[model samples]
Target: MKGQDYYIPAAAMAIALVFKLPALRNNWRDPLLRSVCVLLTLAGAVFTFAAPPTIDAVNEWTGIPNFSAPLVYCLMTAFSASCLVLMFNWRGGPAEEIRATSRRWISGYATVVVAIMVLFALGDAPEQRLRDFDTFYANTPYIRVMIAAYLLAHNVAAMTMVAMCWRWSLQVRGWLRGGLVIIVAGYAFSLTYDATKMSAVVARWLGHNLDDLSTYVAPPLASAGALISAVGFVLPLVCQRTSDSWQTWSTYRRLGTLWHEVQSTAPAGTPGVRMSWWSPAEIRVIQRESDIHDGFLRLGPCFDRRHRDAAYEEALAHGADEETARAVADAAMVAAAVRTSAADPEGTAAEDPGEGERVLIMADGPRDLVRISHALRHSPVVAATRRRATTADG
Candidate 1:
């Protein structure tokens, strides 16, 4: 792969990591968050160090030939371990079990990373091979073992990821399942990467040169696999958050009709709860609902059960379902109460409560409030009732 291929993914992972930093800071002890951060960090490091330009620069800077080879191998090994640890945390078993499993994986990969460094230190590779280190050193003593060890570690991680994600994907649904399926595909690419790299190395040991496979084919495959897996990890989180925000905003909008109607009849100079413009959607929704219920309490004296009963019958006659009819009835009564409250600001025209007449607002929750709001905006029966009330008032 070209330098841009490596650097672009590195930059992308950096951006993703930046986005998660705030949440990570807030919940640093959260196992899943920690795992995600570690995975992104290691993945970015792997890509950044694996780029040909960066490899040459590191070798030149350190004055150690092919120093980047072991460094990149160590980072990739750590990245693989991070992926497994993330999966363990994400799958969510008992906390202690997940911690133990993650620790073991980390320890094993740490050993491999150390072994790669030791082998590289012992091996003599005065000639620098930035892009084809594995192929160039395939016949060297300790370097050969170092190359094989890293590849075997990477291959095992990829196969394990594919199997785990595939099995888990089948057991889940929605965005999580979709993400797992993509993860499986990503790891499948990773396995192909290992296969090509290993193939070239093995061919070298047999005195044949398939150097192009490791030098060219394998880099692109590795880059593609990492980028795809990053997307798989991020897709569910981004999409789920977006979906939740949309739902909250939608609820806030749906409640607007009823909220406005009630607010219009609120007594002049009554104390009101004010929220900041930048409040979260959920907070805004709760505030609006609270204002609506407060309006209902203020308009309680103006409620006439007869208006609701008549509108309910009219709605049923017009073929509204029972639930819709109930919504329409509640909407009609709210509309009439708004008119009555407007005419009698002192509430002098309020009727005494009839025994067994339940207060409509108190009888239902937020969902019913949304249904009534929708009915208030669209129900023909409620519209007719509002027209009649306006006429009677005029």
Candidate 2:
């Protein structure tokens, strides 16, 4: 039975471990700490599993029995208590005061837990033993206090953790915010069941009745808690991966829509017809390139930042000096800006391409052609610009 109680926590621990690895971030949001606590809870489960069966069958309390139940559960309590301590500590950032305070809190809790465990051990006496067959109970005074203190300590700690997570959810996000709460709630449920069982056992002993309510109440709650905590731990991993995928897809979709719009705007064979005006070239140009001129062609018009960077890198790598690279980069920027700006005012006299005395912004030069590769790599404007310049020059 105790084995069953610890198993859920064990499962929670295992799930939390996935977040602990260094490949993942070690922030408070991370589940590594939670995982450690669950594992410790699992350790508690082990002792409960081992001792409960023997106690349950002992109908008479007269034997000089080993009082390992509370002692072992105390160990579990320490693990659970330690978990709450860490969760509380996360509220403190880099400030020394917060850190010192958290440390002090942990130290105090630790002392209390150790002292309580020892008290339970020391307080047990042969005369105080409930030695009647067909009856089970804690008929001793100190035993009662030790159990109450331990449970009370755990309850206080677990609920505080839940409240902390709840408070953080006001501004927090992802798994840390949600998972912390779920884990806290689960532990809370399990602990409450435990405390309630302790209360019931006391009542049953006083009345000389043997009703194992703790056994009945605990396992199911622990299982439910295990499931909740497991979800809490794994949900963040799923959310993150999904978010990245959504962002990537959104970017590609935007780029695709832009490509279609540019294609439709170009006039047939006009190079950069209305649709193609802002687009890049399709055919790559092969002119004098630098030392590694054989690199991939990324044709772009005189615009497009990414395309321009690629062109700039290519130009420098292919042996073009800094002066040449700067000139090409600057010239492309000016042309792209000019084209975009010119298109803004429809019906304005300044936009008429055939108007006399206009330079026509010829993109036929060798410098322009080299940079076109960069534009083509980034946007559709490169191909359109190339076709326009080729037609105009011819």
Top-lDDT candidate index = 1
TM-scores for candidates 1 onward, in order: 0.91, 0.52
Model 1 spans > 4 angstroms off: 27-29, 351-360, 363-365, 391-394
lDDT (10s digit) by residue, model 1, range 144-227 = 999999999999999999999999998999999999989988988899999999999999999999999998898888988988
The lowest-lDDT stretch of 10 consecutive residues in candidate 1 is 351-360
RMSD to the hidden true structure, all candidates:
2.4, 14.2
Give the per-residue lDDT digits (tens) of candidate 2, residues 228-323. 644554465456656766654443333332233233333356433232333322211121221112111111222345434544565577676775
Supply the global lDDT for candidate 2.
Answer: 0.48
lDDT of each structure? Answer: 0.89, 0.48
